[model samples]
Target: MSVIWKGVFPAVTTKFNDNDEMDFAAFDKNIEAQLEAGAKGIIIGGSLGEASVLSDTEKIELLKQTVKTVNKRAYVILNIAEQTTKAALLCAENALKYGADGLMMLPPLRYLADKHETLEYFAAVAKSTPLPIMIYNNPYDYKIEVTLDMFEELSKYENIQAVKESTRDVSNVTRMINKFGDRFKLMTGVDTLALESIFMGAHGWVAGLVDAFPRETVAIFNLAKQGRHEEALKIYRWFLPVLELDIHPKLVQYIKLAETQTGLGTENVRAPRLPLVGEERTRILAIIDNAIANRPELPAGSWGVEA
Candidate 1:
């Protein structure tokens, strides 16, 4: 439970092969790149990971793989987006057994839980595990906002230490800070708004585009944290177009394609999510490739491994 719950934690995409099987080798490469770029943790089986199609066993296996791949270099957090509190508890419990350091938990999906129900569900899972939890409050997408009042109640659980804040409204960052102060560490979840969120007092980023451009993502946060706003903004501007990909419905496909272009991963996503094709594919590639061509140079100092 000693996780920092800050910095660039990638909501990683689950790497698959053309056969649609889990491709650990491809997965490992991207992970190595993440670590090298100084990600704070690895959030597996998130929306970006194609979590819905992955079975429970597969999720567990993914956790095991991440724990091994990370090798104590960073935190390995499993995303729990289940339909029932019972199932989420089971997932969180299993995550602890497999060496996960923390969890990025959403409200019970499929049901669109109301406030009381959402609070109860989160409480059940929070009390179920000793591992620290970062409750994901993304109302726009998930249809459940873990409001300040809800957090006031959940704050009783010591392990519920952080939040993946994706409310889309930057002002909410200040509101949370105004009420809760330091009770919950905040990590921004949206890629497009990440730099602004961080400047507004978000402690870290549960980043999406980091799957492909880990260095730039990490550098933005690292530099901004150091009060190098001018430098951070420079990279963020060049990064804007590519960062928008994370907000798309086909984000998994879009990011995987970016990974392939970067030599960090492949474009193979799980089924029901076919690889991006035709005009859409061409359009997305234009954005990614264009970013690649005009990528900015980070400050030549020790930001991380290569700095």
Candidate 2:
């Protein structure tokens, strides 16, 4: 079955309580806000969602809850960021068993597998489950670049359907289109580069900041798709500072704090990843507050029209 992988899909954060347990109340509230704000899909257990820290039980429960909360209104994608092929396959199988509509998988976690190893690994997981896969090609963060040559090899798989292109090089968007055409549905993975990627013909955005400012994020994509570049840029210029938080080392904490300020969720994160403190916390809050204080009034119309 072909999944139409288009529109803004937020790499949502996993909410936790002060006691370090998954906070279902906050989690469900965030999901409802994203769906209500017209996000095309919700991605759970991603790097933004703190996948590395979450246990298998927690990951599975999150997937099940997201699938239940979305209830066919939007796609629920489970991010598989495991180290071994075996573990990756197991997660894929479990995601399917728990009702994930699709998956967004990174290359071999932490090992930085080479071209041949990466291709084989993705091919294995793609074959393990029938769910459509979005290959996350974020060389900047993951240190593994899924080159055009590797994509060519993986393209033979029927289920490897989309890519979250986050090389941080906007030109790579054109390069992928120039080479593969539509074999892989290209979704811009970086929050800051979203408008440029859309302008360059990317099919969608797997966004980060949308967790806090869903309407503006959706508005930028829809306006650009509608050829309203001026309107989109107006929002984009105002949105740039907050979007930068998505690329930071402390993105989970930063974004969660933004969520709290916006009344969407809490700033509570798991241990080893404490909440932002001191001046850093104050600075992030100021950025979010300034934007909120001067938040642009979105043009009146329906948003999130699929590209």
Candidate 3:
């Protein structure tokens, strides 16, 4: 239970060339944009970063580059979820070697579970690194869920500092906070539920939308932290459309498109994960454009989408 592992950690998308190799320059630029925009940390090689598609060497290089570029301004978290414990250990060791601030891991996929196996999966990964660990509890993405009872047990780990709680159920969040309030730091991963989670006493947001709208993310969290409910609601209303887009599996495509359209990061991504096209592309672009046009008071690129 370390307290250092809390706040708005955006899972940064890894940039790539058309040939599908790691594009270090673009990746660094993306990290810089996020740090400058007020992200508490950069989550390199998470789902948003297409970690599954990345080669082992690419993941190592990306972590190395992230450490070099971030220069310690924010906490650095690396996502190391694989189908095997040995694979997770190897990746976790690599991240720790590069001086990462923490590690986030999901349960081993493809296993039909018993509670015993689930506990083993996490304990094995936690044993791999001394760095603070954030259990990435996204049942929708990983299909392996960690129950609250599981949380009570896992919180006993000296290194298991926080839970990246992506379950959109506010009641579940409330229960976790009420039960494990003093034990684990609960960070919301669902952007649409972020303000609510904070107000409910959850620690912070591990946000995807923060890459596109860091200022708004900061404003929402800051106002809520100060008990300014009405002001926070105002910012949340303006940012809701963009925030709601993150509810989809195609979040990477929409956020990247918004980035390119507004000059935050390149829209290019690795293979096996193609860019948005046709109706998807058109709809995302239009919404971003309309939002920017309506908020002329917010500068060009202030919102990280085209005006």
Write model 3 residue lDDT over 178-250, tens digit each, in one string. 8877678888889898888888887778888777666667667766776777777887888889888788878
Model-by-model lDDT, in order? 0.90, 0.90, 0.77
Taking all chains together, each candidate's TM-score versus the true structure is 0.98, 0.98, 0.92
**lDDT of each residue in 219-272, candidate 1, tens digit only:** 999888888899999999999999999888898899999998989899887777
Q: lDDT tens digits, residues 112-229, model 2?
A: 7888899999999998889999999988988999998888898899899999999999999899999988889999999989999999999999999999998889888888888888
Tell me which residue pairs clash in candidate 1: none
Of candidates 3 and 1, the better by TM-score? 1
Question: Model 3 reaches what TM-score against the true structure?
Answer: 0.92
Name every residue pair that clashes in candidate 2: none
Candidate 1 Cα deviation (angstroms), residue 262? 0.7
TM-score of 1: 0.98
